[model samples]
Target: MAFSSGSTGGPMANINVTPLVDVMLVLLIIFMMTAPMMSYPIDIDLPQRSLNPPQNLKDPPPPISLRIDASGQVYWNNSPTPISALRNMMETEVQRDVNNQPTLEIDVNEDADYGLLAKVLASAKNAQMQKIGFVKK
Candidate 1:
């Protein structure tokens, strides 16, 4: 509480915020002291370096090649395979290695039809083949 003192005015009521400010500062200090202690350090066992050479895991299989000639003819593994067989072939290849999916490399001729290339990509995706890359001649 505060009062106004003047030559010709009555006493005026005013709120003293000093106590509120002190309480807020105390609460801030309490939070700052306790915030750090609230967190606990986690224990972890990290991997150690070994002197022996690392053993080779499963060898990566050869990438399956799909070639599209200028005339829009599609070839699977250098052999003529129709567009209809692409999905089935891709599915079988994926099933062969369930753990590591085989990579499919599409080699498209410079003059190959865009529609044909799109169809090939769609077929590979439909078969759930994840690793598909383009092979530039």
Candidate 2:
């Protein structure tokens, strides 16, 4: 018995995937060749500490709040105060109730002028208010 091929688009034959496999293999090889160079490696060596007991330090408590609003305005403990009057006020406050434990906490809004903030910090430092810190609000 002889078998006859299908009609229409000539003899119906199984598609050979060899060419497709070869193309895919070549692409994979090309990608492999370029991949290593495409990516760079980073090497880092972290510092190691000696095995010893850590020293303990007491954290100061929340300080007196000094707020600076966006318009370069200063607030002494939430109340607006003029820059001309700030230094004296801070001095007085720091000296208030000697046993009050002096510490100044300056909180500044994000839009507040940094120059004004620096002046505030400078005033605090000049007044000898030892502990000063800034808080974002």
Candidate 3:
């Protein structure tokens, strides 16, 4: 005599919620697993300096560049100079700058003899050039 709602065959209504609950739980677990790996902690208190940067940051022109080639030959500022003469010249330069010491930059090629490079460095020292450095190229 009377009609009811959501009851297809009888007087009972049922809904299947297992699939929807499974999907929601799977998504929650995925997010939980990935949240910890997303970001890492970096602990450091970096110091800040108020000093002005130098004008020639890349490379500064040294007083002299002593180059030793593969053939056991040396050049003083792109000119041929014997080790003895180079030593003497450096000695003279050092003497001229009595108050402040001048620096020498030695540039040795990869194929250059190691012994020759050592000798050149020694000569620079003997000439009183204390601030000596090697060039990468």
Which model scores highest in TM-score?
1
Residue lDDT tens for model 3, 37-126: 998999965758859855544443356878888888888889998876877888787887544566688889899888888887788767
Clashes of each: 0, 0, 0
Q: Which ranges in model 1 have alpha carbons more than 4 Å from their true place?
A: 1-56
Which model scores highest in lDDT? Answer: 1
Q: What is the lDDT of residue 105 in candidate 1?
A: 91
Candidate 3 least-lDDT 10 residues: 53-62
Residue 49 of model 1: what lDDT? 89
Task: Order the candidates by lDDT, highest first.
Answer: 1, 3, 2
lDDT values, one for every candidate: 0.89, 0.75, 0.77
Q: Which stretches of candidate 2 lie over 4 Å from their true place?
A: 1-62, 97-100
Q: What is the lDDT of residue 2 in candidate 2?
A: 31
Shift in Å, residue 71, candidate 1: 0.4
TM-score of each: 0.58, 0.50, 0.52
Clashing pairs in 2: none
